[model samples]
Target: MTKPDNPNKTRFGFETRMIHAGAAPEPVTGARQTPIYQNTSYVFHDADHAASLFNLQSFGFIYSRLANPTVAVLEERLASLENGRGATCCASGHAAQILTFFAFMEPGDEFVASNKLYGGSLTQFGKTFKKFDWHAHLVDTDDLAAVRAAITPKCKALFVESLANPGGVVSDLEPLAEIAHQAGLVFIVDNTLATPYLCQPFDWGADLIVHSTTKFLSGNGTSMGGAVIDSGTFDWGQNDKFGGLTAPEPAYHGLTFYETFGDLAFTTLSHMVGLRDLGATMAPMNAFQTLLGIETLSLRMERHCANAQDVAEFLAGHELVAWVSYAGLESDPYHGRAQKYLGGRAGSVFTFGVNGVTGGYEMGMRVVESCELFSHLANVGDARSLILHPASTIHRQLTDEQRDTAGAGPDVVRLSIGLETLDDLLADLDQALHRAAAEGDKAAE
Candidate 1:
């Protein structure tokens, strides 16, 4: 039987694509939603067909460890939303990072990444990646000179968060992309914070985009998934550094991915090699949940940003607040970059320092514990508002200097604004601030 052509082949707006892209009524059951293909393995038509699937000559699922129908829809939808040629979905955002670098780096390879990133990412690059003999040079990406100086011959890529988590620091993407291309390094952006609804990193010359779809893309805190999308513009054959793509693969009967797959080489290699070996495939049920979440991404993001702006502004003026670092505010250092890259929406997740009589750590904890409206949790991008004290929780492994630089300092409280009534959010925060202050005063006495 011949494959049926996609009805959604025509280009559409992001909002439309979010709902309709990569999906058609189930061929057999006429289901409108992408149904979960929960089985572990697929039977091939014949030995010839099985050989083709195993050899990567055809794109079909052989095992759940590599691909699934439900996850494929999520990958396609993400690729459409990001305006990229292809995407690969995995178990979580961290898995997405591992898959992306696995495609490029061999042993003894190096990469440069922005120092300001999710605390987990910093630890992954600086610590876990070292286990693979892959070294990372963490640098202040804001300083172009420093970034240039950090890139040596062994460096394979440059990584940065499009909007640094918790810090509200918006990266200057265009110049950073230029710098990466000049140094012949692949540019990778973690777009978890600034979802495609707010900023499309591919629009600014990014070669690759990664997302912890567990966050904004999933939106409701119900699913865990990650994705890596390829722009399909990088020239793997330009140099032999990326042997995984350009060189022959002994496992697949001397298949040269770049020569055979062309624009899809990296994405194909990611599935055939990365997912096949690493086994970080996303579950079909999780993909279905995420697809449902993504359907209303634009709507949720607009409300999230608006609520965050109001909350940030309210905190900026609160007597017990030391500082707020949301780029939506004009006084923020990265306000200009936010305007250029994120359409002036500085995302909903940001940090503010709590002013305390003794120390920020104590006051910050009090404020978090005092909030009634916001749920105190480690996760973000929920339909409900969430809060965290990063220094004690997410950034606990980092040293004092590291936490401060990443904007997850002792006094910092990170807020993930949700679709709550603006007045209620304000009142809740206001009460929390005063309550914390009162408690701090009693402690002093």
Candidate 2:
């Protein structure tokens, strides 16, 4: 296959790049859309070519389990968008996290991470990772002093979410990156909430970026996929701590990744070893759907941000609302950090608390259930508005103290604003609020 011209030479802006980067007319039929290569294996030129491909001396797809043409296009596009050297696709965001750990961590090793992260991630780190004998120290990532203090000699990486989920807290990536570098550790960021459209973590000094493409990248609530993009900036050769990449490998015939692949060491090793062993590779069909969704990412994100601002403003003045926690609002505690990092667009998700009369959590649940325009669902980043009462649903797994730490209190409701008309969304909220109030009043009486 012929390589496309350099994306940098085109001087394309983000929207144009989203639609065109890493995409070209189909070689087979001149088709405009990206065609999914559904075959399980590719043919070799001959026995010598097959031998070379299997030995990793030459680049060629041997099996869909290792790589697929459809998935490769998506990976290249995402890498270009994120300004990373390369990327690896996975079945889900959790799978991407596991692959990252498998590549860099070992038994008895620890990593320092932010306290404010998605609840699912918190559980994964605090619980699931223990099975591997790896540990995590959760610290306030915003406080550089605390982060520095938490980093032990055993720490191999610094993990943070660009914009934390549910809580909407934004980490100071530049400072965090500096800390990681000074400590001789890799820096990993979960960019699922912010998306590349809002913030590219690599620009702020992250070494490895992870995303759940099932969300904003796939824009319309279709397909479950994830990605890990290597910035190709981290010097594995400089650090003796990361022996996984710098040391000789047994699986690849004593080959050292840093010596062989240089900047692409992390990404290549992630695919060649992590994916091969873990079996978390993404399907070609899912990658195709995500690619289609990403093409319109810039446009969808604009609408989502605008709608969220409208809803946040409306909620702030409502008598039924006790508090609103949207970073777009000046009243929010994280407003300053959000302004500094979020490019003036405080994403589409925020949490608001309803004033409890006598019904308490029931009143909040009623408000969520009564919304006609917003679907009550666990997912976000849909074209349609979505609402969730976490205390009774997503955060139910946490204890009261844990729920508070996760920012999912009983009266709080999380909203993912959609492309629906602002007026219609307001009307739905108005009706829901009234219904909730009436139910609360009845309970009080």
Candidate 3:
């Protein structure tokens, strides 16, 4: 059967491509929507055809463990959006990170990472990876000298978040990517917070981009998914350090990925070997939901950023607020970096400290609990506002010093601004703040 050509020919904008790309009218049924291929296996022409599929000589789905048609469309769409050679979807963002590392790093290898990161990522690198004999050196990535000093001979990658969680620090990907290349290390960027709509890591020299689609990519809170996009720009053949790509694969007929697949080796291996062996494949239904959310990603992000800016400004001057740390604020230390990298929109998530006039941690919790419009949840990047006290929740396992570094303190509250009206959000916050303060005063009296 001849493959149908892509429907839209013109180089449409991101939003346009989101709804049109990877979607074509079904040739067999003439259906307008991309139908879900829910079956676990596809019928082969014969035994020889099945063998060719197993050998990676042909592109056809033999098993859902390796690939699914419904999932493939989403992967292709994400790869196009990211300007990457290809993408591999997984169960969650953490699964994508683990699978990506497993594809490149051998036991006893190390990677350098920024100290400021999502609490889950920090825990994964600092604790979980160690169990596999893979080590991570945490360093202050903002200081070039410090980054250079922390690299060891065994270091294989330099990892950073495009826009860090909680702290809202925007990484200078260009400089960092250059540093990684100079050091003969792969540059891995988590584009979860910024999403591809606001920033494409590959455009700034990133070799690999990872996303927790559960956040902004999904837009709504319906599904949990993740993806890893390979820019195919990194020359794995140039260095002997990465033998996984350059060396012969003992599992698949001694295939040398770099020689056989070239630019697509990383993503191909991620799907064929990483997800195949690890069993971290994303569900076809979830991928479909993610693709649905991605269709309006650009539109939702604009509103999210605008609403967040208004909320940030209001919190910055409020008497009940002790401090506001939003990159959109001119007073923020990360303002310059955010402006340079975040395309003038400082994102929807920011952290602030409620004045202890409400007492300490307990009062802060009350403020979060009292909020009428904002849901108290752990996740971010939802269309609805989310509130969380990370110190008592996500970062509770960390020491005080560690908490400070991760931007989660007893008085600190994190907000994931949604598309709600600015007036409604502010009013809800105001009522919550007053109630928390009154409770604190009663306790003191």
Off by over 4 Å in 1: 1-10
Model 1 C-alpha lDDT per residue in residues 137-228, reported as the tens digit of each score: 99999999999999999998999999999898899899899999998899999999999999988778789999999998899899999999
What TM-score against the true fold does each predicted structure earn? 0.97, 0.96, 0.96
Q: Give the C-alpha lDDT of model 1.
A: 0.91
TM-score-sorted candidate list, best first? 1, 3, 2
Model 3 Cα lDDT, one tens digit per residue, 1-445: 1112322123777887788777888789998878888878899999999989888889889888788888888888888887777899999999999988988899999999998888889988888899999999998889989999999999999999999999898998888988999999999999999988888777777889999999998888999999998887789977788899999999988999889998879988988899889998898888888889989998899999999999999988898888988999999988887777788888999898887654568877988998999999999999999999998998887778778887887888999999988899999988998888888888777
Question: How far is 141's C-alpha from truth in model 1 (Å)?
Answer: 0.6
Residue pairs with colliding backbones in model 3 are: none
Per-residue lDDT for 48-76 in model 2, tens only? 99988877789889888788888988988
Worst 10 residues of 3 by lDDT: 1-10
| lDDT at position 188, candidate 1 | 98
State the lDDT at 33 in candidate 3.
78
Ranking under lDDT, best-scoring first? 1, 3, 2
Candidate-wise lDDT, in order: 0.91, 0.87, 0.88
